[model samples]
Target: MQCSYFDAGLCRSCTLLDTPYAEQLTSKQARVEELLDAHSPEWLSPIASPEQGFRNKAKMVVGGTAAAPTLGILDGRGEGVDIRGCALHLAPIHDALPVLARFITLTGLQPYDVPSRRGDLKYVLVTANAEGELLVRFVVRSEDVVSRLRRHLAALQETLPNAVVVTANLLPEHKAVTEGEREIVLTSRDRLTMTLAGMRLELRPQSFFQTNTPVADQLYTQARTWVDELGPASVWDLYCGVGGFALACAAPGRAVLGVETSVDAVLSARATARREGLDDVRFEAGDATEAALQAQPGEHPDVVIVNPPRRGIGETLARWLDASGVQHVVYSSCNPVTLVRDLEWMPGFRMRRARALDMFPHTTHLEVVTLLERVDSPATDRPRVRMP
Candidate 1:
């Protein structure tokens, strides 16, 4: 779990690297309980993540020269730190980093210089699944290097045969963003398949997937277990990125609808649904709040699963859910501070059970999933089990 980058102060992304792994998990569990203990809900044991080689994705900034490109974060001076050997990345990602760096040289693609803003490539994004297949993306300033990338892609693929998907993303602006609107496919394959809990999840280039693949599976499995215990006939997954939770909860008779804003993600989700022959499960590209607010009483689901951003669900959606009178809600949040704020809006619902998942280890970040029930719902109330 030791990171040379952290010890040398080259990269402090893992702020808690100095602390022991046991202490990190203990601190995270203590913090989450302090935030939610007032609700007096049953607490499940916190899920711990692997200490090293867990991240499935690497968003390395392209810096330095084309002859010797650096694949890592930029220093305060806007120069690359060359952290290709970062311990957080999975084996496939670590192996592909050197190949990608070599590809930059072979393609003669200039790495973007932050202060000067006079280069073609900005970032090299690489994502790998459990199967060892990879999706490589080069974020460039323009289409100026598209021809070079396409021409030498075969040469790069020779070294990294597991690179099934390759793409180029244009970020024409002089801003600090990672990608742009236009994307060009460099390989025949356009999607990467990530298998979790006996289900295959396809991911388009822009589709969002968890960086920690193993921990993500645990997260989805926990959600599925809770949903099965509740046995809701109909469920709505808001902000459903690639339909991970929605697909996980899908049953023969259950109707699951996933709402997401990204069309690519929706397409990926739909493809997976078709492959699995889950006709009752569906996905649509739309805003979560709008879809929730537009749902009529008859269209209301028996359960609503919300995996909102760090901002939580916001007051508007929170207030709507408060008055919607839904029987149950499964809320997954990365920020408990915002989660507590959203809980304040839903006074009609009470937390039944909650668990913290350590999605991001070596840092203060964590994910908490809470099952909420309407205060006056007809379901029989079970006594809350105390946690150790």
Candidate 2:
């Protein structure tokens, strides 16, 4: 993939684009192997996929002028470089850039200047699934430009009828995060629905779904297979964002409980479960680690699925899991370093299967899922360990 924009110094966000995609995958695989060797060698495996145009979400910085809005990286001095047609985005996003830019210009929306911090529109986030339906959210500093935004919304809907959801996020304060306190729906509906792995997920403006929807489908399918093979009587999904794993494992007789911290995500999960008519699936909003600790022995889970943040599970959670009488565990992590670190403390648990899902292409980030099972006896066939 030869990127002329990158070569001309227009944007260096994807610094590895100069290198061959195969070489990049090899390097990342080696890094994962080294981390596993030094920590949990049994979990190491060679799992690499394509690394081109796989990102399903685009978060572009608005800069330059409203007439010619630039979409790309922000420089160290807080300047935006125009690379909207870069090779990393999906084909639809690349094709829609010029049209969106022209619409922004015609609507007279002011592009936010980071250094000066004196504009209404801060950023524009666009998300699309495999089906090509788009969900757009505009992060604005204030809601003073309602009339202008309303006009632009009409124009955008006419131009792109496939846009399922359009929202405006108002952030009156100066913050780096893309979210805000108030979200106003510019469209008739408040949610955008997408299908993944035979399940429908409802996405709001600020909801945190996986960026790579296709690979996310594969990841969830693999997790479901692992759970089914284990024949778990009951399962607990910790840090379950929107209950992806919980809903996948839900069956007629099996019970699955999903625990998450975000109230919106819990509501979405419960709604999905109800829509699918899965009576055995349930979701709750609370501290995942605390819920796990407070679970009574009689309600001991047969399997526990943990999909933690980049930092991985904390020491307290790991200790509690080790003492818990769970027979099987599934761990999904975006950071392999933390995953390996946590696996060292789990006793009598051996790795059964491991897979890598290419979630963020053209970047160093990857998602990994590992299944672990407990050994019944003290003396058993332990797997061989190799150091990197």
lDDT of each: 0.90, 0.77
For model 2, where is the 10-residue window of minimal lDDT? 379-388
What's the CA RMSD of model 2 in angstroms? 5.5
Q: Residue-wise lDDT of candidate 1 within 9-46, one digit each (tens)?
A: 99999999999999999999999999997887899999
Error of 1 at 142 (Å): 0.9
Best by TM-score: 1
Backbone clash tally for model 2? Answer: 0
Q: How would you encode candidate 2's per-residue C-alpha lDDT over 4-45 as one tens digit per residue?
A: 887887776676777787777777777776666543435444
Q: lDDT winner among the candidates?
A: 1
The pairs that clash in candidate 1 are none
